[model samples]
Target chain A: MNIWLLIVGVGLVSLCLRASFLVLLRGRQLPERVTSSLGLVPAAVLAALIAPELLYSSVTGTLDVLNPRLVIGLLAAAVAWRTRNVLWTLMVGLGLLLVAQGLGWR
Target chain B: MRHPEDMTEIIPHSPQFRPAFWRGMRAFTPLVPGVVPFSMVAGIAAVQAGFTPAESIAFSLIGYAGSAQLIASQMVTSHAPTVLIVLSSLIVNLRFAMYSASLLPLFVGVPLPRRWLLAYGLTDQAYAVTMGRPVTEPSPAAYYAGAAALMWLTWQSGTAVGALVGAKIPSTWPLDFAVPLSFIALLVPVLQRRPQVFAAIVSAVVAVAAHGLPFRLNLILGAVCGVAVGQLMQRWQAKSV
Candidate 1:
C-alpha cells in the first residue's frame, strides 16, 4: 500500500476506535465488567509499555535486569509513588540516569 | 425541562466552560516533559523508517498518536504484512476506547460535536489529566478541550520538528529513558487500589514474558491479561469479603 494511503487507513482506524464508545454509548449504561476493566486500562497499558521498555534491551532483545534504565526506572517509580510529583520524578530519574552513565556504569 | 444532554449537569452554560477549558489546558502542561520526547521519537522514527518528511507529517497529524505512529511506520519499514500492521497499531491504540468510556461520566453534558473533537484529541496525557476529576470542578468539555487541544498541538508540532532533526539526535543520549520515567510518574499515582496494583504487576510480568511476540503483540496481550486479571482479583476480593 502507498504510504499516504497507509497513513489515512491508520488515521481512520484510530479515530474510529477512539470515538467508538464516546459516540455510540451515549446515555447508556455500560456493562459492569467493562466499567471496571476500563478503569484498569490506563494502568495496564502503561505497564505493558513500561515493562518492555525497562526490562528488555530492544537492540539486543535480551533481558537486562541490571541496566541503568532499569535501576533509574525503579527509582523513578518509587519517587513517583511516594512524592506523586512529576517534576521531582523527572529531576531525580533523569538525574540518576545521567549520573550513572557519567560514572561509567551501564 | 431537563435536557438529556445535561446528564452530568455540569455544563449548564457555555460561559462557565471557558475558564474550565483554560484550566484543562494548563493541567496538561506538566506532562510536556513526557509527551514532547515521545512525539519526537515518533517523528524521528518515521523518517528513519524511510518516509518522506511530508509523509511523516501526514502520519503524525493523521495518526495523532505517538506509539501508534511509531509502531505503524516501524511495521511498514520491516515490510510486515499490512494486516499485522493494522492489528498492531489497533492494539497499541485500544486504550483510547477505554479513554472514551472514562471521559463519558465526566463529559456527560458535552454536546456531540464538541465531544467528537475531544475524542479526537484524547491521548494518555489528556486522559490522565482529566479522568476521575470531580464533577463540580469544571465542565469536562471545557477542561478536556484545554488539555487535549494543547496536548495535540504539542504532539503535532513536536513530531514535525523531530522529523526534520530527529536523525541528528544521538542514540546514546538516553532520551528514550524519559518515556519510561514519565510513565512511571504517571502510573505510580493511579495505583491507589489493590486491583490496580495487581493489574500492573500482572501486566508487567506478561509484557516481559511476551516481549518476543511478533509485531509487539505482547503489549496487547499484556494489556488484555492485565484487565482480565484485575477484574478477577476484584471478584475474588468481593467474594472473600
Candidate 2:
C-alpha cells in the first residue's frame, strides 16, 4: 500500500508491457495485419478518456446537457475539425468558453 | 556484415552542434503550444492539489504523462488507497505498451544503450511524429532522442512557470479547455481510415456507458473492446478486398 511501492510496481508493469514486443518479435517481422491493428490503440484510448469528461459532470454521475464543460468541449471539437491545429483549436475553444461565460451562459 | 566500429564511424554527424540543437528545437516547435497549456494547467493543478513546487516539477519530469499525473494527484487528494491509484494509473497508461511495440521495429538497429534512452523517451508526441515517417536511412534513436528531449524540456519548464504564475492568472480564462482541445486535435489527424474511425466511435460509446464503473476499470475495458473491434474490421476489409 505504500505509494512508492505502488509507483515502482506501476512503472515496472509499464516497462514490461513496453518491452514485450521487442523481446518476443526480436528477429521476426510482425504480420502486416497485426502492425496495422496497433494503430487503433491511441484513438481507442483517447476516446475512452475524453468521452466521460465531455458527456458527464462527475464520475458515476448523471448526464447534464447544461454542463459548461460539454458545451465548451463541443466547441473545441468543432475547432479541431475546422482548423486541424492543436494550438488554434485550443485558442478558439478557450475563447468561445470565455465568451459564453461572459454572456452569462455558465 | 560490416564491423560495428566501422558502421559507427561512418554514420554522418550533423554539420554543427548549433544546427543540430536548432533542428531538435524545430522538431519540437510543432508541439509547443499543445505542451505549454497542458503542462501549465498540470503545474497549477499540482500546486492547487497541495504539491510543493519541487514535487510538481518532479512529477512533470518523472511522471511525463499529464493525464496520468492529474489522475494520480486526484487520487492522492481524495485519499484513495495507493494501490488503487497506481492500478488505475497503470490502466490509463497501458496504451503506451502498444505504442512501444509498434515503434520497436523502427529502433531495431540502434545500439542497446541508445535504445534504452529512446524507450524512456517514448511519448505520445514522439510516437505521433515518428510513425509513418519514411526515412531513406532511418536513425530512429537520434530522431526519438531529439523529439523526446525537446518535449521533456518544454513540459518541465512550462509546469514550473504554471506552478509559479497560475494562481495569478484568472479563472475566467478557459484554460481547462486546452487539454481536451489538444486531444481533439491529435485525434482528428489519426482518424484517416475506416477502422480507426470505427474504433474511436466505439471506444467513446463504451467509455461513456462504462463511465460509472469503479476504479476506472472501464477505461481498460473500453480500450480492449475498441482494439478488438478495429482488428475485426481490419480483417473483414482485408478479406473483402
Candidate 3:
C-alpha cells in the first residue's frame, strides 16, 4: 500500500463514517425506538469516556476511588449541577486539578 | 434548576441564527487552551515521524481525527506497514460514526454545503458542546457552526505551528487535563433524567470494567450498553406512565 493510497483509504473511511448518516440520513425515517435510543448515545459515550479517566489512573494503572481527579471531578460536578455554568464548572474543576497536582497530591 | 442546555430556553427577542452560532463559539472557548497543545503535539509528532510541513498540515486536514493522526504518525515513523497504519487509525476513529448518527436529527434540515462543512468539523469536543446544547437552541446549525468552526481553525493552526515550530516546544505542561475537564462540564447537565443517569452509570461501570479492552473498544461497548438500557428504560417508563 502506497502512502497516498493509505491516506486516501483512511480519508474515505473517515469521511464515510462521518458523512454517512449525517448527509445520507437527512429526512430519512428514523424509527421511534431508534430516535429515543439515539438520544442516549451522547450520555453513554460521554460517561463511558469520563469514568475510566476519573476512576482509573492513567499514570499509575490503579483504580483509586479517592483519586484526586475523582474527588475534584465531583466538586466540579456539584458546581455544574448548581450553577450549570460552563465557565464555572471548568474553572472550578481544572483550577482544583492544577492546584492539587501542583501541591504534590499524586 | 436551569441547565446550560436549558439556558437558551426563552429567547428575549425574535430567534436568529448568528446568536446561536456565537453562543456555540462561546461555549467552546474554554477548551481552546487544551486544543492548542493536543494539536501541537500531533503536529510535532508528525514532523518527528518524518512528515514534511505540507504533509503534516494535510494530515490534520484529511485525518481531522486527533487520536488517529497521532497513532498514524507514530506508526509511520516506526516503519510500520501502511496497511497496519490505516487499520489502526480506522479503529481509533470508529466513534465518529456514532457522532454522525447522533447529529442527524439536529442537522437533517440544514442545507447542503453547510451540512458538508459541519460534517467536516465534527470533532469530539465540538460534538459534546453542540449535543449538550438545548433542543430549543432555535438554530443548531449556527451553534454548531460557531463551535466547530473554531475547532477547525484551532486544529489547523495548531498543526501548522507545531509542524513549523517542530519539537522545540516542551510537552511537560499538563494541558491534556483540559479535554476531560471540558467533557465533565458537558456531562453534568445531561444527568437530568433517570434514564440518562442510568445509562451513564452503566457506561461508566462497563468502561471501567472493560478498560483493558484492546483498541479501547470498551468505550463502544459501554456506549452500546448504556444506550440500550436507556432506550429500554424509556419505553418501560413510558408504558408505566
Candidate 4:
C-alpha cells in the first residue's frame, strides 16, 4: 500500500462515514436513539486510547510506575481534573516531570 | 414550550463573511496558547524521524491530526511498509468518522461546497466545540465553518513555527507530556453523564486487555466494546425508566 494510496483510501472511508447520514437521512428524520448513540463515540474512543497509555507503561508488559513518562502522565491527568485547562495541564505535568528528572527522581 | 416558529425567530440572522471569519478567529484563540508547545514537539519528532520541512508541513496540513502525524512519522522512521503505516494512521483516525456522522444532522441543509470545506477543516478541537453546542438555526454550517477554519489556521501556523524553531527547544522542557495533556483537557469537558463515564471505563479496560492484539487492533476493538457498553447501558436505563 503506497502511503499516498493509504491516505486517499482512508480519506474516502472517512468521507463516506461523514456523508452517510446526509445521504441516507435526506428528507427523513433520524431515529432519536441512533442519533444519541453517536454521541458516545468520542468519549469512548478517547478513553480507550488514553487509559492504557496513562495507567500502564506497556501493553502486555509489567507495570512500571517508575517510568518517568507514566509519572508525568499521571500528574497531567491530575492537573486536567483540577484545572480543566489544556495549557495549565501541560505545563504542570511536564514541569513536574522535568523537575523530577532534574532531581534524578527517576 | 415555544413552537418551531418561535425557535426560528430566536436564531439571529446569519452573519456575513467578515463577522463569520472573525468569529472563527476568535474561537481559535483558546487553542493558540497551547499549540506552540505541542507543534514544537511534533516538529522535532518529524525532523528527527527524517522528514523535511516541506514534508512536515504537508503532514500537518494534510494529515491534520497531530497524534496520527506523529505515529506516521514513527512508522516512517522504523521502515514500516506503506500499507501498515497508512492502516495504522487510518485506524487512529477512525473516530473522526463518528464525529462527522454526529455533526451531519446539524449541517444537513448546507451546500455541498461548504460541506466539502468543513470536512477538510474538521479537527478534534473543532468537533469538540461544535458537538457541545445545542443545534441552532441560521446555518449550523456557519458555526462549524467558523470554528474549523480557526483551528485549521492555528494548527498549520503552529506546525510551521515548530518546524522552524523546534530544534532550539530543549528536551528538558517536558513537551512530551503535552500531547496526552491536551487529550485530557478535551476529555474532561465531555464527560457529561453516567453512560459516558461507563463508556470511558469500558474502553479503557478493553484497551488494556486487548493491547497485545496486532496492528493496534486493540484500539478498534476497545472503541467498539465501549460504544456497545454505552449503548447497552442507555437501553437498560430507558427500559427501567
Candidate 5:
C-alpha cells in the first residue's frame, strides 16, 4: 500500500476510535458504573503508557532494573507529586538525566 | 428549548465561554515546552523512517496522535503489513475511546459538527485539562474547545517543525525521554483520589508485567485491569467509610 494510503488508514482508525463514544452515543446517558470507571481511564491509561517507557531501556528494548530513566522518572514523579508543576518536573527530570550522562553513568 | 445549532452559535459567545476558553489555554500553556520536544521526537522519528518532510507532516496530521504517530512511522519503516500497522497504532490509541466516553456527558447538547470537531481534537492533554476542572465549572464545551485548540496547534506545529529540522538533532540528547517525563508530570496531577492512585499503580504494574504482549496490547490490558481494580477499590473504600 502507498504511504499516503497507509497514513490515511491509520488516521481514519484514530478518528474512529476518538469519535466512537462522542458521535455514536450522543444524547444518551451512560450507566453510572461505566461513567465512574471511565473517570479512571485517564489515570489508568496514562500510567500504562508511562510505565513501560520508564522501566524498559529505549536503546536496548529490554527491562533494566537500574535504568537511569526509571530512576529519574521516579524522581520526576516525586517532583510532580510535590510541586504539581509541569515545568519543574520536566526540568528536574531532564536536568538529572543530563547530569547522569555528564558523569558517564549512562 | 435551544436548538443544538443555536448552541454552537451562542456557546462561544456566552459570557462563560471566553474566560473558560482562556483558562483552558492558560492551563495548557505550561506543558507546551514539554509537548514540543516530544512532538519533535515524533517528527524526527518519522524522518528517520525515511519519510519526506511533506510525508511526515501528512502522517502527523493524519495520525494527530503522538505515540501512535511514533508507532505508525516505525511500522511503516519496517514495511510491516498495513493491517498490523493500523492495528498496533490503533491499539496504542484505544484509550481515546475511553476518553470519548468520559466526555460524552459533557457534550450532550453540543451540535453534531462541533461534536465532530471535539472528537477530532480529543487527546490526553485536552481530556486531562478539561476533566480536571472542578465539578461546577461553567461552559465545559468551551473549556474543552479552548484546551483542544491549543493542543491541536501545539502538536501540529511541533510535528511539522520537527519533521523539517528534527533530523539535525543529535541522538545522544535523550530527548525521547522527555515524552515520558512530560506524561509523568501530567499523570501525577490527575491522581487525587485513592481509587485513582491505585488505578495508576495497578495499570503500571500490569503494563510492565504484560510488556510481552504483541501489538501494544499490554497497554489496553493494563488499563482494563486498572479500571476494574479501581472500581472494586472505590466500593471497598465507600463501604469502609
Candidate 6:
C-alpha cells in the first residue's frame, strides 16, 4: 500500500463519513434514537480519544498514572473545566508540561 | 439574546451571509494559535516517519484530519499494514458522521453542492464553533465556511512549517501533548449534564481497559458503549423527573 494511495483512501473514507448524513439524509428526519445518540457523540468520542493520551505512557505504552502527561493533563482538564476556554486550557496545559520537563519531573 | 452591537437590523433583512461569515471567522480566531501547534505536531510526526516535506504536506491536505493523520503517521512508521492504518483512521473519524447528522437541520435549505462542500470541510473545531452559535442563526453554511476556511489555512500553514523544519524541534518541548489538551478544552463544555458526564466516563474507562485491542477497535467500542449508556441515562433521568 503506497502512502499516497493510503492517504487518498483515508481521505475518501473521511469524506464519506462526514457526508453520510448531510448528503444522504438531505434534511430528512433521522430516527429519534439516532438523533439522541448523535448528541452524545462529542462527549463520548472526545473522552475516548483523550483518555489514552492522558493515561497511557507514550513511550512504554502502558497505563501510568504518575506520568507527566497524566499529571499535566489533569491540571489542564481542571483549567478547561474552570475557564471553559480553549486558549486558557492549552496555555496552562502546555505550560505545565514544559515546566515539568524543565524541572526534570518526567 | 442578540448582542447590542448586532447590525442585523440596519441591513436589509436578507439573511446577512457576509456578516455571518465574518462573525464565524472572528469567533474562531482565539483557537487559531492553539490549532497551529497541534497541526505542527502532525506535520513533524509525518516527516519523522520518513515522509518527505512535500509528502507530509500532502498528507495534511489530503487527510485534513488531525488525530487520524497523527495516528496514521505513527502506524506508517511502525510499518503497520495499510489496511489496518486505514481502518484505524476511519474509526477515529467515525464521530464526524455524528456531527453530520446533528448539523443536518441547519443545512436543510442549503444547496446540495454547498452541503457537500460543507461536509468535506467539517472538523471538530469548525463544527463546535458553528454549533455554539444560536440555533436560530441565519447563514449557518456561510458561518461554517468562514470558520472552516480559517481553520484550513491555519492547519496547512502550520503543517508546512513543521514539516519544513521538523528536525529542529526538540523532543522535550512536549508538542504532542497539546493535541489532548486542546481536546480537553473542547470536551469540557460538552459535558454540561449528568448524562454527558456519565457518557464520557464510561467511554474513557472502556477505551482504556481495551487498550490492548488491535486495530483501534477499543475506540469504536468505547464510543458505542458510551452513547448507549448516555441514552439509557437520559431515559432514566426523564422517568425520575
Q: For every model shown, what is its TM-score relative to the native structure?
A: 0.78, 0.79, 0.62, 0.76, 0.77, 0.81
- Residues A1-106 of candidate 6 have per-residue lDDT tens digits of 3988888988988889899888865556767777677778778878887898888887688899989899889888888788777677878888887788788777
Residue lDDT tens for model 1, A1-106: 4787778778887888778777766656668877778778767877887888888764566998878788788888888878877667777887998798899876
lDDT of 1 by residue, B45-147 (tens): 7877778877888898888877678667656765766667677677667778877776776666666765677778888778878874556774667777788
TM-scores of chain A across candidates: 0.75, 0.64, 0.73, 0.66, 0.75, 0.78
List, residue by residue over A2-99, the lDDT tens digit for candidate 2.
54454465555555555555443444565776667667877886777677767776324587767777887877787778776667777777787778
Score candidate 3 by lDDT. 0.74
Over the stretch B9-102, how does candidate 6's per-residue lDDT look in tens digits?
Answer: 2232345777888888987898797688777877888887778899889888888988788777766866777888888677678778888888
- All DockQ scores: 0.54, 0.51, 0.37, 0.48, 0.58, 0.60
Interface RMSD of each: 3.0, 3.0, 5.0, 3.2, 3.2, 2.5
Query: Higher DockQ: candidate 1 or 4?
Result: 1
**Candidate with the greatest DockQ versus the true structure:** 6
Model 6: CA > 4 A from native: A58-60, B1-20, B77-79, B132-138
Tens digit of lDDT per residue, candidate 5, span B57-142? Answer: 98888889887777666556657667777776676677788788878778757777778888999998888889887677767787
**lDDT tens digits, residues B1-241, model 3?**
2223433422324267668878999989987876776677678777777787778888888878776676566557557777766765654466676688777767644555556667878888898899888767877767887899899898899989988987554455444454456566667877889999999999889989998776556666887888889888999999999
Model 3 interface CAPRI class:
acceptable
Scored by TM against the true chain B, the candidates give 0.76, 0.75, 0.65, 0.72, 0.72, 0.76
Worst 10 residues of 5 chain B by lDDT: B1-10
Which window of 10 residues has the lowest lDDT sum in candidate 4 chain B? B1-10
Which candidate model has the greater lDDT, 3 or 4? 3
- For candidate 6, give the lDDT: 0.80
CA lDDT of B116 in candidate 2? 53
lDDT of 2 at B17: 30
Query: How should the candidates be ordered by DockQ, best one leading?
Result: 6, 5, 1, 2, 4, 3
